[model samples]
Target: MSGSETIGSYLNRLAAGRPTPGGGATGALQAAQGAALLGMAARFTTGEGYEDQADRMERIASRSEEIIRRALKVSDDDQEAFAAVAESYKLPGETADEEADRSEAIQRALLGAVEPPRELTRIAAEVIEMCAEIVGVVNPNVLSDVAAAAESARAAASTAIVTLEINIRAVDDEGTRDELRRDVERGEVAVATAATVTRRVRDDLAR
Candidate 1:
């Protein structure tokens, strides 16, 4: 979607019958929102005595911007891959040769569907870690925003991981499955990081 598009419109499209902008896309969109919140918090922290940390904040902001863009594209890629998988299933398979071709196409499509969510899980985890760092450095007034960002990142990472896990099951290649399993393990660590960060945020809010 163009940067000019409204979020409401996107949500409406998501709710529509079309499957292009599905759960994986939503996960990416949520992470982008989290990234935007993190950038907003970082923007508030870049001044006065914070000059030393300003550079780090700028770097985070830049990377978050990139991630946001990539996530949106991944959202589109995920749907295209999904469509490929669905269409592959429809390929004619009455004959032996047709069955072989259809099977090959489906397997390739499954791999295609597996990739975007895996990348999304990885990036969302990084965004979550960035939130953990920002929670300490951001102005107290915007602490709540950082907290929201962390929560969103956690949800986004978790969602993408679920999508990844689901698609991984259709993949018959043991090597690819093992690699994705490792990615899931790493994503679980990211979820733990987000939980720890959120716990600190909760503590701060209580105090």
Candidate 2:
């Protein structure tokens, strides 16, 4: 899985009987798309008399691009981790002692699947916050694009949190489950905040 692989190719592989590149990967891709839209809005606003926010937009644009790149990489990581888990599941465990081995394998796989999406949720929340700040500041001509970015970020956050929840439910460790649940709650708060901010910005602009 080279970074050079196009999204279409990546998604095709994900859909092609592969266990990795599941919901976590899709959530990361959604976050990346949102980040890209944020960068686009920032770039469009940089010139054209939007000077007050030019420096901020430039910073946001750069950060957004970097975050998107990182997010895309995480998508690949999710796929790889999932594959590793699936492979572990195939290991033979015929003896009573092997029961422990199987449990360990399942736990490892569940952890692998959980961590990437948890990170995805955090990063998606950051992207959402950045978009919320820029929503009204960007070029009015590209307001819709800004809104789209915000919406994407919201969706990504929501999806990532859901993935986290699903994975947490599979974990036998109560402590780990509690921690993941808290993280998901935080991500949900961020998503809600971003949505409120975006909606206000959009409504104000319409009026």
Candidate 3:
């Protein structure tokens, strides 16, 4: 999941039987797409009739550039994290000691894997917030893009929650599980905000 890979190439790899570039990576990309859309809308919210909102749009566009970079990095990191989990499962376990070691390794890998999607959920929340900010303020010509951004963020957060939940199940530590559950809750909040932003955009369009 190199950032430089073409969309077709990434899709081809994702469609393969491999474990990496799976749901987590896809979720990260969705967040990135949402952020990119927000950045575009913000950029269009400048000059002439938008004088009062220029500064706010500029700030959003700047922050969105940063979020897009972070999301792409998370996307790549997710593939590597999932690959580590897959490799941990391949560890030899013919004896009791080996089995214990293998189990420990798998648990450690699963714990490590949660961070990427957690970051993704955070990114989704940020994107959704930006969408909310620009929903009515952005250029009316591209107002629908705000809803599109919110929907993408919603999808990303939902997918990230699922990915994190699957990894959390294999993690035996109660404390860690509780922490991951909190993150899932946060992602759910972000999903709710995304829905709100989308609904607001829809109401605006209906008017």
Candidate 4:
């Protein structure tokens, strides 16, 4: 999606029979939405009662903006990366040399394809952390939005990790797979934290 692409336009493209803007891109967008909601909550967490937290809220707001930008860029990058993966599979491989070259290219492309979603999971984890920080402090008016943000981050992390897992499984390097496994572990932690945040919000609402 371009910087100016409408949501409807993007949805149309996503629904088409193409593969570039798939789960990885969707995961990035989910992270971006989560960060955006966090930013809004941070901005609202100000005024007389929130004076002691003004500096902290400001920092969260700033960092959330950065995360949102990075997540959107990741969305675009995932499209390009997945496109490269598809192209790598198309490489001519009839002969021995060509087959060897194609296999190497596909492995390289798969590794490259994993990075965007991996980064997205990191981003989602950070978003979840931010939500954890502000869940108790954000304005009551936007309290539920904090949970919404956490849930969005959870979805982002889950989707991105799935994408990462599939790509990493196809990758031949054991060391790289080990590293990605750690990233998946972190994504799981983020998902758990997101659930905690949602529960906290629900508890508060009950009270």
Candidate 5:
């Protein structure tokens, strides 16, 4: 990871024959972009005599950046978890008695696959909430960028929820599947709430 590494380059490398930096990494990148936009709004607002709101904007900017960094790290974690799951699937099971071992391995792998996107949805929702809070307060000149951040956050949340649901569907354990289904439902509600907030903020800025 060079300091000059553009996101496109990073994503290209991840998408290459490498197993890491899959959907989780891509979702993180989307969240990072949103964070960057929020930071931009903060910077603009802080500079243009909006000193009264600077502290709040600064907090939002910091939180957004932290979320982006965490999301990026989670991408690597997701890849590593997936690799571990793959290794588990390959565990020696030559005997009929190994059935339990195989089942355990499969369960672990399913859990690994479910975790990354679950984290993604949570982070995306956080970013959205931050964006909503800062939307109308930021420099009006940068309202479009704020909107972009909100939209990107919403997209990331939606994508993450879908990924989680797909992984959940692949799990063999009914209990785990049901738990994941509930998570999916919660994610849907969060995304809808975020979308509504984004829309209201955009409308307020328009006014």
Candidate 6:
């Protein structure tokens, strides 16, 4: 995206008949949005009356920025990874040697496709933890924003798990598959924990 494309332009590209900006890229973008919300919530909590929590909020803001920046990078990486996958599928598959080469390329590309989403999963978990930390401690005025952050982060983690599962199914190496499975499980657990905390925030907001 070159970091300069408008939101509408990006969405148009995503909606077009193209495979580059697929599910993995979208998952990273969602995580980025969640991180942004978390940062905003922390910003609201850091001034004047909230002096006691200033340090924590400042840390949260910093970490949240890093997470979102990483997510943008992940999005770009995922697009490139999937583009490679699409190209690999187009490799010739006529003779025995040709078929074998095509298969090898596809396998390698599939493995490459798993990486960006896995990194986003880790980042989303960190964002979820930050949301949990600031839920009650953030400015009461932006409690809804904090709650939204938790929900958005949970959604991002959940999406990463789905993307991981799809890619891991095609993985040939048992060791690599096991590692991917562990990552997916970790992401699932992180989302579940975020959901628990978000429910508390929701209940409190309701009261």
For TM-score, the strongest prediction is: 4
Name model 3 segments beyond 4 Å from true: none
lDDT by residue (1-207, candidate 4, tens digit) is 666999999999999988969988988999999999999999999989999999999999999999988999999999999999899999999999999999999999988888998899899999999999989988999999999999999999999888878867798999999988998999999999999999999999999
Tens digits of per-residue lDDT for model 1, 102-144: 9999999998888888888888888888988888877888888
For candidate 4, what's the RMSD? 0.8
Model 1 gets an lDDT of: 0.85
Writing each residue's lDDT as its tens digit, candidate 5 over 1-207 gives 333678788868886987666666677667777878888888888866797997898788788778878777666677777787778888878887697898788787878778877787777777777777777677878877877887777777777788777777678888878877777776687578667767776687678
Give the range of the ten consecutive residues with the poorest summed lDDT in model 2. 1-10
Q: What is the TM-score of each candidate against the true structure?
A: 0.95, 0.91, 0.97, 0.98, 0.82, 0.96
Judging by TM-score, tell me the better candidate of 4 and 5: 4
Clashes (backbone N, CA, C under 3 Å), per candidate, total 0, 1, 0, 0, 0, 0
Error of 5 at 5 (Å): 4.6
**Model 2 lDDT tens row, 1-207:** 456888688769778975666777887888888899989988999765887887899899899989888898888788888887788788778997897898799898888778787888788888888877887677888888877887787787888888888878789999999989988997898788777767876797789
Candidate number that wins on lDDT, 3 or 6: 3
Global lDDT of model 4: 0.93
Q: Write the per-residue lDDT of candidate 3 for residues 1-207, one digit (tens) a residue.
A: 566889999999999988878899999899999999999999998999999998899999999899989999999999998889899999999999999999999989998899998898889999998888778678988888989989998999999899879877888999988988988998999999988888887888899
User: Worst lDDT window (10 residues) for model 3?
Assistant: 129-138
Better of 2 and 6 by lDDT: 6
